[model samples]
Target chain A: MATWLEGLIALVLIIGGVFLLIGSIGLVRLPDLYTRLHGPTKATTLGMAGLLLASSVVSSITQGSISVHEWLITLFLLITAPVSANMIAKTAMHHDLTPWKRTKGQELVDPASRQAPPSDHHSVKDGKLP
Target chain B: MLTWAVIIVAILICIALFLNLWRLVQGPSLQDRILALDTMYINSIALIILYGIHMGTGLYFEAALLIAMLGFVSTSALCKYLLRGDLIE
Candidate 1:
């Protein structure tokens, strides 16, 4: 392989590695379940994509044949990661997993505790209040 | 040069895998454990791909693909179980 191609592969590998490291660190260091979900779903998926991209490039350049397996894996990950994250988020919501104390939108998580409208105008407009 | 880069990246990924394991071991809740497990398999796929590159062979690609498919399915199934308390329902 040419020096430039080698550099490109190295660059991709390092970038993916850094993102993977960051994702796992976030998983370990984040304070709450909701926050922890951010790490693997987003950062790790991106890192995997980078790694697969590098693999595809390596296969193509070194072996002189188009390799679609990496592409297939990358596509699968990209398509499924968000779905799984959404499912996990739903599970957390179903279990009422608390977000980090500093996290906003607490009221959104539980509507009963949400503060009432200052004047009930909104409720009146919805025609629920009598 | 490529070898050195791959080595450094492999070490980094290994550390990442360890972190994932730490979370899996100590996660406070079931959802956290599931999330940690999800991350672990994905990181493993990255490691396997790295190994494949190091060996300059396409043989490992299938294994990586298999891991990816199984990881996604297992994650979804786990989440479904948590949400509905039943895998099929």
Candidate 2:
């Protein structure tokens, strides 16, 4: 019975590994900044979750008790992945980084044009666009 | 039977790693590279857990946690740099 359980845990780990690899590939192969961002943010999060789940399961089985640390890491990964992606995208916008244009799409509007109105946007509200 | 299953999973993970490596090397922009790095961080965590299983030691779990923490910090720093033009002002 114990051996059976170990096998199952190992299977989960393998599957999780596969997901991780796929996420990495997307990070490498996607074109354009925004498009590439989608790959790692979405796929990699799932991948990590799978691996963590497998680890937690195995640890629980081996130690005869629940393993919560792996779960915590998984939780952290899920929450941070998207948030980090957002931060990067927003920063790209702030720094005037250009997004890739695939098909002559409106000549790629200036990043400044997408700025929100300067009312509650800035914290100080010192008559400056924040 | 269980051993067979574990072996199969290991194979799959190896394939996935190859795919991710391709992305890491082929990324055309700096942001993509950063994304790849983030993915790599997650992968490493998973890899560490698997290594723990293989070695039958719980210590690798601690290493995985550390990797997770470092990954988050590094990615945050990179994102900040990407946004503000400097990691520290």
lDDT leader: 1
What 10-residue stretch in candidate 2 chain A is worst by lDDT? A103-112
* TM-score on alpha carbons, each prediction: 0.89, 0.77
**Model 1 deviation from the true structure expressed as Cα RMSD, one decimal place:** 4.0
DockQ (CA atoms), all models: 0.86, 0.59
- Chain B, per-candidate TM-score: 0.97, 0.85
**Given candidate 2, what's the lDDT at residue A94?**
60
Model 2 misplaced stretches (Cα beyond 4 Å): A2-7, A95-130, B1-22
**Residue-wise C-alpha lDDT for candidate 2, range A1-130, written one tens digit per residue:** 4777666766666666566666666665655676777767787688677767776776687788897887878887888888888776665556566666662332333423365443434474655536
Which candidate wins on TM-score?
1
**Model 1 regions more than 4 Å off:** A111-130
Compute fnat per model: 0.95, 0.70
- Candidate 2's residue-wise lDDT over B1-89, tens digit each? 54554566566566666666666687655666676677677776766776776665688877888887888889889878766678779
lDDT of 1 at A24: 97
Worst lDDT window (10 residues) for model 2 chain B?
A: B1-10
